[model samples]
Structures are given as C-alpha cells and as structure tokens.
Target chain A: MAQLTFRESIARGIAQEMRRDESVVFLGEDVGAAGGVFKGTVGLLEEFGGIRVRDTPISEQAILGAAMGAAMTGLRPIAEIMFSDFFAVCWDIVANEIAKSRYMTNGQMSFPLVIRSGNGGGLRFGAQHSQSVENWAMMIPGLKVVVPSNAVDVIGLMAASIRDNDPVVFLEAKSLYSSKMDVPDGDIVDTLGSAKVLRQGSDATLVALGAMVPRALDAAEELATNGINCTVVDVRSLVPLDTATILREVSATGRLFTVEENPRLCGWGAEVTSIVADEVFYDLDGPIVRITTPHIPLPAADALEDLAIPSVERIVTTIHKSMNS
Target chain B: MASTKVAPAQSDVAQKIAMYKSQFALRQFETRAYDLFLENYVKGTSHLSIGQEAIAAGVAAAMRPTDWTFATYRGHAHTLARGVPMTPVFAELMGRTNGLMAGKGGSMHLTSVEHGVMGSYAIIGAHLPIACGAAWSAQYRGTDQVAVAFFGDGSVNIGAFHEALNFAAVWKLPVIFFCENNLWMEYTRTSDVTAVVNPAADRASAYGLESIIIDGNDADEVYEVTSRAIARARAGDGPSMIEAKTYRHGGHSRADPGKYRPAEEIAEWMAKDPIPRYRLRLLESGVSESELLEIEAQVNAEVDDATEAAKAGGVPGEDLLMKDVWADGGAAWRN
Candidate 1:
C-alpha cells in the first residue's frame, strides 16, 4: 500500500486509464503545462505528453462540445470544467447535447467519455465556485453520476468512469483534495453502482456521499460511545444507485438517515429516502431523517458556511436524538 | 476485376453529373416531404431545404465518404446528400420504426453514422464546437478526414459560433464551418440581425481564416469552393469557413406560409432556383437534354418508391422504448 492524497489519486487514476487505453485523451484549462488549476492533474502532462493532455482556452462549451464530438468518433476523451458551478455557462451542451445524443441517435453512437469537475464546498470559494451540483447531473437521464469520498475510491471510481461507455459526470470534492489515505499498489478498478459499507452497526443506517462519507463515519464513531450504534454507507454512484444494498441495510436496521453535503431541496438523499419509504414502509422503526446543508447559497464566512452544511456533531446529535426518541 | 481508365476531363464531368443527381434527389425528397406534411403523414414540424439543394449537393460531392458532416434542423437535404437512402430519411421524418434513428430523432435530428452523417442538430450554433472537436480527433489520429458543420446565417450570431471558430483556429483543426445564408432567419431577415453582409465569410478574419462567399444557387460554384476547402483541411492547412448565399423556398417550418418576405424578393429568388439553373447549365455544357431528363426520371421514381416504403413502415414497438438509453442497451438505472 502507498499513501496518496485525493488529488494525487486523480492523476494516478487518469494515468492508469491512459496507459491502458490509447483512445483515452484528456483536456481542460491549465491541465497541460499548468498541471490543472487545482493541481489534481499534476503529473499527467509529463507522462502522457501534449497530444493526449491538452489545455484549452477558457471555453466550457468548446471543451465539452469537443469532448462529445471526439467521443462520438473514435477517441475516449475526458474533458474538465474548472469548477462544478461553471456548468451553468455550458449546461445546454451537458444537459441537452451530451446527455441526449446517444438516446436521440438511438445508439448509433456511444460517448465513452468522462466529464471531471471540482465540486462542493468547505473551500472558501463562496457561492459560484463551491456549490455541489451532483444532483444537477443525477437528474439527467443518459449520464452516470459518481462522486468518490476517499483517495482509494477516487482512483478506483475514476478508472470505472473513464471505462464506462456512456457519459459520466465525475464530481470530485474540492475539500477532500488534501486528504490522504493508503491505496493498494497496482491498478484499482471498481464497479460503478456498488456502494461500500464502511462501518457496520445495528441502531440506525446512515447513507452519505462524497465529502459527507468521512463525516458520517466520524459521527458513527462518536455515536457508538453514547450507546447508539450507526451503520455508515458510502454511496459512490448516484445514477445506477445500489438500491439493493441500501434497501437491505435500511430494512435490517429498520431506520435510515441520509447525510448530504448538497442543499436540502431535492438532493440525491431525497431520492434514496423516497425509494426506502416506498419499498420498505412496513420495515421502518421510525420516520427516515435527512441531515443536509440548508437550502441557501453557501456563505463565504467560515462560521456561517460551517453552520449551513451538516457537520459531524449534527449527524451524531440527529441520529442519537432520533434513536433515543 | 477489369481495369477501366478514364480521362481527367471525363472524371470532372462525372462528378458534376453526380452532384446534379444529388441536387435532384434533395429537391424531389423535400417536395415529397412537403406533400406528406400536408397529408398528415409527416408528424411534427419540418425545416425544409427546398431551394438550398446546391450547398448540400456540392458539399457532399466534395467530401470523402469517411468525412463527417454535421447539419442543422433544416437538414433532410444534407442527410440525403451524403447518399443516405431516401427510405430511412423519409421514414424518420414520418416517425416510423424503420426511421434512421428508429423514430427516436424525428424530423429535426436525423442521423446515419454508417454514412458519416454524424447528426442533425436543432439548436442554433450548438454543433459548431462539436464539429471542431471531431476535426480535432481526426488531427490527433493523423488522418486526412475533415469535419463539416452546416448551419444557417442565424447561427453566426450565437456565442458558440464565435467560440467554435476561435477554438478550431487556435488548434488548427480540420473543420469547415459552412453557413447557408438563406436570406431569412425564420421570419426575420438575416441581414437585419447580422452585423456583416456575409455572415460567415466576413467574420473569417477574426479567426485568421480567408473570407469566402459563394452563390448557393449555383451548384458548380459550391462544388468548386467546397472542394478547395476540403483539400486545404485534408492537407492540414487548418479550418475554413464558407458562406453560401441562398434563399429558402418556404417558411422556417411546415406551419408558416412565408408571407413575411416582400413579393418582389420572393419572386427574384424563386426565379434563381438551383434545380432549374443547374439543369440548364448541364444542357448548355454539351450534356444531352435526354440524359438530364433520364436522371430526373430516375430520382423521381426512387423518391416515389421511398415514400411508399416509409408509409408502409410500422410504429416502434414498446421494447425499443426502454432500450438504448445506456451503452448496456437497457434503461435499468437501479439494481
């Protein structure tokens, strides 16, 4: 095992795919010589060279449009939008064109491409750059949505996303960039729809995604000392949701709580909660609870931003109170 | 196989004849579509390329079979020009199971990947950058294949147009941005909304490309200009933009009657219709009238057969509804 940061694992994952498939090419602003804005792609340029690793102008539409066209042809391209929130500038291409092209064309063409973006808050970038819009991509029909919580999952899931035949919106948490973990040596490929059960407990089931996974695990640890054991499940892929595992875990515990980093309104948690409520209504011990960031623009101030987004303290308190009641 | 040798002059004549046949095919196919729409056979709206057959014919004639062609919503002619059989084109417009996209794309989004007609986009200016991307791929693969993007004058003003142009130029991608300047953008005149007289050609300098404008009604001119541009792109000389000045014979869609244009302007353009003009030119160039008439008859017969075949095609089955949503050929999102 080797210790690697989430940012390093991103480059390692992309490099692994590029080495495996000659068709895979990557492009974005400052991804070439500059090693990406977030430095998530630090060593790609030196290893892959300029032909495969390209740096485009600050044109989101062109970046995505080019990637789509390239994907439809012969190349398996990975295009990056600098920030996740920058999707607003080029949502039409992502939502209308890339998402609908294969279906509209009746599978005459398949886009083997991945759109990678730096997503979510906890960085002091404020509203425009920090919003978690994984839900935005989850709603689109033809796209596979993935958000990895740790360095290991990042390498594995990034490989899977690149290998996927359909378009995948791979959202990487900006807050988790510096976080480090030991990943096994050699290629680490994982399945797209499988959610990993991080911690096993009996009292309550906690489903979390991306940045929320680590927090949920911490909360579970703290809740255990208070005599309330919680099971934490990391939902890696949102589109091809592993409802079998989720429903099984929820049914086993007979109580479920969602920990979401995204805003409360129609978040991915809502979808999971709805499915659990509908399918296993009789198995529930109490009403399912959701701990999420409030439905408001993320504030710039640290205190307000921390208060808005769900914290480890909040998750423990909510699950503890609900279980006790 | 027996070897057959032909002179260069004869080869040129053959190309011209093929272009003429393509033009005839587009005109007849579009005329049939119009009749079908009136008879309620063609469901939804259709943006016809009735009077602008020369551009599609000329561009297709110049392109290699492997070259990719991207067209707009007004793209039945462009699709047919790539030698995609009229049956699938007709069936797609009519929304039948045998359609080019199995009735998924409808009239506005006909696509035939086997024939290199990548897609027919409905959104204005969206496919320009996409075409550039395809061209970028070809360049990366070190192929002589070129990508051509076809749009109306209205697309010139969209942000994607400018972005695609700059992107292609910066990367020196092998793409041709072909703008069919059909005078009107829907109900309004393109000239009123556009800043320059030639929407595509005049803006070429901003992207370090030569400005070019052709008489879209003249098949010979379109063929020659497009051939040159294709050669330049194939030779790695970078992208080119061509503005073909033509006029649409009808309104933007089947719904409008096109009363918005002045009577005199309409009459002038109708008189310059590409079909008759190309036929007259062919006759004047020592091509026998009998030969031209024979070609027209063949196209008419073929179109008639295709229309019948499309009408006979059934609606799509329920199984196809949930298929092809993902690469797995199923729409199962949850396990």
Candidate 2:
C-alpha cells in the first residue's frame, strides 16, 4: 500500500491509465509543461510526451469539444477543465452534445469521454472560482457524475471512469487535493454508481459527496460520542445513484440526513431526499433532513464562505435534530 | 486578389454539368418528397432543400467516404449526395420501419454511418462542436479523415459556431465549416440580422481561419472551393470555412410561405437556378442535349421508384417506438 496525497493519486491514476491504454490522452490549458495549475498532471508530459499529454489553449470549449471528438473517433480523452466554475463558459457542449449524442444517434454513437474539474470553496478563492456546480451536471442524463472524497477513492474512481463507455463528469474537491490517505498501489479499479459505507451505524444515515464525505465522517464520529450512531455513506457517483444501498441504510436507521456543499435548493441533497421519499417513504421514522450550504452565492470573505458551506457541526446538529424529532 | 495559379485537374464544363445534374437529381428528389409529404404520404414536418442542392452536391463530391459530414435541418440533399439510399431516406421521412434510423429520426434527424454522414441536427449550430470533436479525434488518431459541418447563415451568429470554429483553428483540426448562406433563418433575413455585407466567410478571418466565398447556385464553384478546403484539411493544414452563397426558394417549413422574402430577390435568385444554368453550360461546352435529357429521365425514374417504395413501406410498428434508445437493449425510461 502507498500513502499518497489526493493530487498525487489523481496523477498516478491518469499516468497508469495512459500507460495501460495508448488511446487515453490528457488535454488541458496547462497540463503539459506547466503540469496543470495544481500540479495534478506534473511530470506526465515528460513521461508521455506532448502528443499524448497535450497542453491546449485557454479555450474550455475547445478542450471539451476536442475531447468529445477524440472520444467519438476511438480515443478515450480525459480533458481537464481548470475549475468547475469555468464549465459555465461551455455548458452547451457539455449539456447538449456530450449528453445527447448517445440517445440522439439512436445508440449509433457513444461518448467515452471523462471531464475532470476542481471544485469546492475552502481556498478563499471567492465566488467566481469557488462555487460547487456538480448538481448542474447531475441533472443531465447520459452523464455519470463522480465525486471522490479521498486519495484512494479518487485514484480508483478515475481509473473506472476512463474505462467506462459513458461520459463522466469527475469533480475533484480543491481543498482535499493535499489531504493524504493510504491507497493500494497496483491496478486500483473501483466500481462506479456504488455508495461506500465509510462508517457503519444504525441511528441515522448521513449521505455526502465530494468534500462533504470527510465532514460527514467527522460528524458521524462526533455523533458516536454523544450516543447517536450515524452511518456515513459516500455517494461516489451521483447520476446512476446507488439507491439500493441508500434505501437499505435509510431503512435500517429510519432516519436520513444528506450533506452537500452546494445550495440547499436544487442541490444533490434534494434529489436524494426526493428519492427516499418517493421510494421508501413509509419506512422513515422521521422526516429526511438535508444539511447544505445557504441559497446565496459563495462569498469572497473567508469567514462568510466557511459559514455558507455545510460543516461537520452542521451535519452533527442535523443528525441530532432528526433523531430527537 | 486573383492569382494566376495552376488549373485544377478537372475543369471541363461537361464534368461540371454532370455534377450539376447529380445535384438536380437531389433537388428533384427533395421537391418530389415535399410533394408526397403534402399529399399525406409522408408524416411529420418536412424542411425543403429546394435552392441549396448545389452546396450539398458540390461539398459531398469533394469528400471521401472516410471523411465525416454533418448538416442542419435542411439535410435531405446532403444525405442523398452522400450516397444514402433514396428509398431508406424517403422511408425515414415517412416514418417507416425500413428507415435509416429505424424510423425513429424523422425528417429533421437523419444518420447513415455507412456513408460517414454523422446524423443531422435540428438545432442550428449544435453540430459544429460535434464535428470539431470528430475532426480532432481523426487528427489524434493520425488519420487524414476530415469532418465537414454544414449549417445555415444564422448558425454563424450562434455561440457554438464561434466556439467550435475558434477551437478548430487553434487546434488545427481537420475540419471544414461549410455554411450554406441561404439568406434566411426561419423568416429572418441574413441581411436584416447580420451587419456584414459581402460574405459570411468574412467572419472566418476573425478566428484566424482561411475563408472562401462561392456562388452556391454554381455547383462547379462550390466543388472547387470545397475541394481545396478538403485537400488542405487532409494535409493537416487545419480547418477552413466556406460560405456558399445560396437562396431557399421555399418557406422555412411547411407552415410558412416565406412571406418575408421579397418577390424581386426570389425572381433574381430563381433566374440562376442551378440545374438549368449547369445544363446550358454543359450544352455550350459540347455535351449533347440528349445526354442531359437522358439523365433527367433517369433521375425522375429513380425519384418515382423511391416515392413508390416509401409509400408502400408501411408505417413503423408500435413496438419500434421503444427501440434504439440505447445500444445495450435497455428499455426506454418513460420518466
């Protein structure tokens, strides 16, 4: 087993995939010589050379468009959009073309493409750079949205995404990039659309994604001290959601609480809550609760931003409130 | 700006007219298809390709089967010129089980991967990015296959069009953006919307791409410009934009009569009808009139056969409604 930071894990996975498959190539603004803005692609250009690990112009549309085209033409392209917030500049390509090609072509075409973007709001990067927009991608059909919280899961999930035939929106939490964790070194391929039970409990089911997974784990530990045993389930893939696992957990606990960094309204939590209500409403002992960021845009002020996002304390409190009620 | 360069390999008027006759066959097919559609044989809304036959014929003639081509709603001519069987195309428009898309994609959406014609989109400039992506894939694979994206003059103003063009130019992808500048985007004239006067190709310079403006009514001009663009693309010289200046004689759809177009402009454009002009040119260049008549008769017969086949081809079975949504044979999600 090798202990690696989240950034190194991502880089290792990409390098391994590129080595394994000659068709897999990486394209981004500074992914070649500069090794990405966060060094996630460091030393890749030296190893793979410029043809495979290419540094594209600062056009997000081109980066994504080229990746889609490349994927269609028998190349598995893993494109990096520097920041998740920048996806707005090229949403048309992502939403319409990438998502609709398979269904529109009557199964004649497949977009085996993966788009990686750094998300979350902990670096004091302000509103433009810090917004969590994974929900926007989750709403679209024919796209698998994966959010890995740690180094091990990131490496495993990314490899799976590269091999998957469908297009995947891989969202990486910026704050968790430097976080270190022990990961199995050789050929780590994880199953997509499956929730990982980080810490099993029976009192309440705490569902989270991306950065919120760690916070939910922390909250579950804290809740254990207070006699409230909370089960933490990391929703790795948001689209083809692991509803069976969620339903089993929720049914066992009889209490549910979802944590997400995005705004409360129309966030991923709402979708989970709706699923639980629609599928297993009668099993719930209490109403489902969602601990999410406020409906306002992410603030530039560090304190305001911190307060805007859901924290461990919020998750713990929401769990307690649901248990008591 | 004219330079005395070496002549093309085939500039004979007879060859040009033969190409024009092929285009006329496509035009005749579209016209007869529309007539059948009005007579209640074909279901769904039909978008005519009355005046833009030359653009499709000229461009398709210059492309190889390995090269990719995509088009907008006015895609019948493009599909026909790309060698998709006429019966299947007409059956598709009529929503029959024998259709190309298995009767799923009606008039607006047509696809034939065997001919390398990537499906046509109903959206204006949506296919530009897809074409760019496909072209990029070909370049990445180290192949000489080029992608051609055909759209209307209105698509130039769209964001996807600009974005795709800019990306293609910067990446030097093997792609050609062929804009059929038919002067109307669903009742809005290109002149009324855009301030640019001469050719829509002028916008290509802004993206640092080579641009060519050709008389779309002239099949030979279209063939010449598109051939050069295709050669440049295959040679890895990067993407080019060609604005084929043409006009749509019919309405935007079956519902509108194209009331927005002026009678004088329509008359002037009709005077340059691509089929007759090329025939006259062919006759003047020593091709016999009998040959032209024979070609016309053959085209009419083919169109007639296609119409009869399409009419005889029964409507798609109700069970087919659930087919081809996904490749893995999954049921279509009703929700």
Candidate 3:
C-alpha cells in the first residue's frame, strides 16, 4: 500500500525477518553503525542491538566464512560483502564450503546463508568496485543466485533468499537501489527460479536482469509506440533460471534479445542465449542476440562507462537486428 | 549455558605425562589405520601425522570436548586427538557408507559434528575464517567455549589467513590460531619463501595479537601455553596467535620421501623427538619402566584393533557416488 525504494524494501524485508526469527542476524562492514554504505540497513542496528546487527571488519573472507559457520550451526546470517568485486577474496569459502556443505556432508548440514552484495557498472566506481560477478556464481553448482530489478521484487527475493535452505547469492544492483515502486501491503513471499514478464508482446522477447531489466522495459515501451511490440522478462534469479517461462516467451515471439550489464564473454546473457538456441532453435525466426558490455574492465570515466554498459537504445537495436537477421 | 570449570590436574608431573601418553594412543591408532590405507585395503590419498604426534595430543589434552577445532589436509592426528572414534575416521578415508561424512568426504575432508570437530579443509588457510566464525558464534551465544584452528606455516601466507586474523583481532573473537611451523611448505623450506624467519608469532604482532612461540617438540610446553590462551579466550580477553615451532619427520604426502631436507637438520630434529622426550621426562619423574611399557602395549593393541576394524569395513557402494552432490531439496541447475 506504501511506496518504497528498492533499497528501503530490502531494509524492511531484513528487519521484518529479523523480528520474526531470532536466528536472523546482520553482519558486514558499515552495516551496523553506518546503516550500510548505501543506507539499506539504516535503522537496523538501533533496533536489533549490536549482537543482532554486527559491524564486522573489512575482511570479505571472514564475513562469508563466519556466515557459513553460523548458518550450519543454527543461525541464519544475512552477510553483506560491500562490493561484488570483493567476492573474489572469499570465493573458496563460498564455492567450496558454503555451496557444497549440504552435499558434502551427505545432507547432514544445510547452509541457510544469504550473501548480499552490490554490483553493476552504472556509477563510476571503477573496475574494482563495479562489474557484475553473477556469472561466476552461476557457474557454481549449489549456489542460488538472485538479482531483483525493483522494490517489489527486491522485497520478495530477499525474503525467499533468507528462507532458502541452501546458500543464496543475492546481488543488489547499485544503480537500482534508489529506484521507487508501489509495493503491495502485507507479507509477500516470492518463489525462487521464477521470472516476471513486465510487458506482453508478440514481436520479440527481451530477457534481462538486475539494472538492465528497467532499461529493457523502457525499450519495450518505445518499441510499442512504433507497433513493434516487444515482450520484456526480468530474470530475477540467475542460477536456477526459469527456463520454462523463457522458452515459452521466446517460442511465441520467434525473436530473442538478451540484455545484461556484465561483459559479453561467458556472461549470464550468453548462457541464456545458448540455452534458448539449443532448446528452441527451430522456433526462432532469427539468431538470438545478446546486448551486453564489451569484454573489458569497466572504466572510471562517465562517458566510457555509459558507452560500455547496455542502454535502452542498445536493447532496441539488438531486438531490431535479431528480427531482421 | 553456564560455565563449567575444568581445573587443571594438580597431581605430580608424572601423572600428567601418563595422561598424555593415553592421548598419544589415539594418534597411534590413526597411524596404524594409515597402514590399512597404504596396503590397498582402503582407497584415496592419505596424509599421516606419524611423527608430529605430540602436537595433537598436547593441544587437545588442554581443550574441552565442547571447544571447536578445524584442521588441514594432514588432519588424522587432530581428529583422533579431538575424540572422533577411530572406526569412522578410517571408514571415511576408505569411503565407506558408515564413514563420518557418509562416504561423501574422503581423507582431506573429514568432519564429525558430535565431537565438535567441524571439518577439515584441504585448501590452505581456508578454514581459518570458518574457525573464527565458529568462535564468534560461541561468544555471541554467551558460551565460554573456545575455537582452535590448526594450520601449517604455508597457510599463514595466504590471503584468507590475513583476512581471518584481522577480523578475529578487530572483533576479539574467542579463537586460538595454532600454526604448526614444520619448517617446510611441501618441498620448499619456510626460510626460502617466508619473509619473516623467526616464527609465525613474530608476524602476529602486526595484527595486534598476543603471540607465543613455544617448543612444539615439548608437549608440556604446548599444553601449558595453550591452556592459558584457552582460559584467556573463555574470559573474553581476545584471540591469541601461537606458533608451535616443530618439524615433520615424514614427507608432505605418501608419494614424497622428503628427500629435500638436509640429513644434518633431520638428525638434529630427530634428537629432540617429542615422544622420546616426554617418555624420558616421565621416567625421571618417578614413573616406572614397567608402567611405560604397559602403556605402549595397550596403545599398540588399540591400534591393531582399529586397523582390523577399518580393513573389514569395505569401500562405499557404487550407487553412492552421486548421493551427496546436493541437499535433499532437488537437483541443482547444471547449465
């Protein structure tokens, strides 16, 4: 019933979960006293106290490892790794320990941990702080990777991630943190591995995720004005991808354009394109197109960063090219 | 949970030494278990702690059953000393259905939750952060239980080690980072790679931690220092870094013979062998030779029994290869 930004929705989701379940706790740099660098956890510390809302040292490995241990023992820890790039510092713990714990111990252990981090390259945070590392997580077997596009989806996805019995990598796009939307009142629980179709059309299907989802919607609207009705689906979850929905949409449109902010090579978009091509090749009228950032490190310069990332215009162009080809 | 006071034994030094010999019996049990693995009765690579028996026996003697511990690849000594039954540990190494991890984890990755031995990781320095997390949990739950992480010197140089220590120091987690500086990281000498030559304790100061460099060969010294650190951690003082300066008589793995070490250095360390050193000390402190021989015979019989039991327990079933790949929820997306 109330309008809230994506960032505020996440904070409310975490706060509600922490209140309902005493096992839920927050840990990360600047998450407690400072309410996180982006203010997503602004008032949590004051409400939960230092024990529940902890300000951890700037050690990504320990932050993740500690979360894994706590999750295995009995606590559900929502750990924040300031930036997605810093995830590399603790990949071994994430991939080897947390992800594989449930399987490695033969179902004796379950890592019910939620690892939240900011990703994407819209802001000039440079190569170190920027870049979408969801593809790396998608490569891992046991992890469930989610990247929500708006306030409503963020709230829903965050709750699902917290409730998941396995480890989940929740990537919050920094560019979409301040974006506002009117979310429905009462509790909202969304299912994992499901996609949302924002716009319905028959001309082409546009698959996108995170910050790129909004851009694809805008592109769909612009194309609608010209009678080129394009369908836009927000792939909120990456690892357990809703291929069933994606395939049905692509089969109807006969043209596909996958959009992502990550580099083109081995990106999430590439994987989606491959899956669609392999499964529904005969249904497609033309070759699948992927609109993504160039395969290079993100630059600090504004103009270069803007040019490097996919835009609405790029999505529209990619859609037209796929239709024409 | 209320604190349980476990006072240190105040009997004569001879009695303490005898208790430690019982702890060594567990390590000897694992050593003989390795023989089953070596004789092809069990499958998978095995890393035995045949020579470094005192380190595990002494450290675990000072720890309570509730305290948490994690070890590296060469973890049989730590697991045995931490009170995991010899049968399951050997069965896990042999990949049996009744193994500690249900045949999912092999030699390098053995875990027993009942014993508070969380698990042993094969990756260098990877478990340091996990150990810190366990310690944090204990402190958060208002428990006085301490967490100990045992790693070789090679792990001290990894990024995870630095990150884990920095976090442990900042949060003052109840943890004891025990570094076994066995003078070598695989084939390379510690001097050839590490910038700090004194010991891992010297580097602890950089992280603002209280460090103690003890003669790891002397079991009594290890027990005394570790007991103090554990006590300090239980009292909420903070984490401590301990550099147990010791040596490995065997090679890094079963394949290598440790031919890289100088004969003179090996002889020098062998002269201060921990088992013999403790044995002599016990004999001089009023323990009779007959009692020592009795202890040895008892341990030898236990080792023989463990080996026989492990050999009788066969390898895991073929259908179990894909059993533990994921939790019982559902299949994970492979694409």
Give me the TM-scores for chain A across all models, comma-separated.
0.99, 0.98, 0.98
After best superposition, candidate 2 residue A236: deviation in angstroms?
Answer: 0.3
Q: Flag the better candidate by lDDT, 1 or 2.
A: 1
lDDT (tens digit, per residue) of candidate 2 on A106-210: 677777889999998898998889989989998887678899999988888999999888889999999999999888858888888888888899888989999
Best by DockQ: 1
Please give the C-alpha DockQ score of model 3.
0.53
Q: Given candidate 1, what's the lDDT at residue B15?
A: 80
- The full ranking of all candidates by TM-score, starting with the best, is 1, 2, 3
Per-residue lDDT of candidate 2, residues B185-255 (tens digit): 78887777886763357787788875577788878778888888899999999998888778888998878
Per-residue alpha-carbon lDDT of model 3 for B212-267, expressed as tens digits?
78777777777778888899999999899888878888788877789999999999
Per residue, candidate 3 scores C-alpha lDDT tens digits across A69-139 of 77766788999999999888789999988887666666667788899999888889999988899998988
Clashing residue pairs in candidate 1 are none
TM per candidate: 0.97, 0.93, 0.92
Segments in model 1 whose C-alpha atoms lie over 4 Å from true places: B1-11
How far out, in Å, is residue A13 in model 2? 1.4
A best-first ranking of the candidates according to their lDDT comes to 1, 2, 3
Higher-scoring candidate on lDDT, 1 or 3 = 1
Give the range where candidate 3 chain B is weakest over 10 consecutive residues by summed lDDT: B1-10
Q: Which candidate do you rate higher for DockQ, 1 or 3?
A: 1
Fraction of reference contacts reproduced per prediction?
A: 0.76, 0.38, 0.55
All DockQ scores: 0.83, 0.39, 0.53
For model 3, which pairs clash? A1-A185
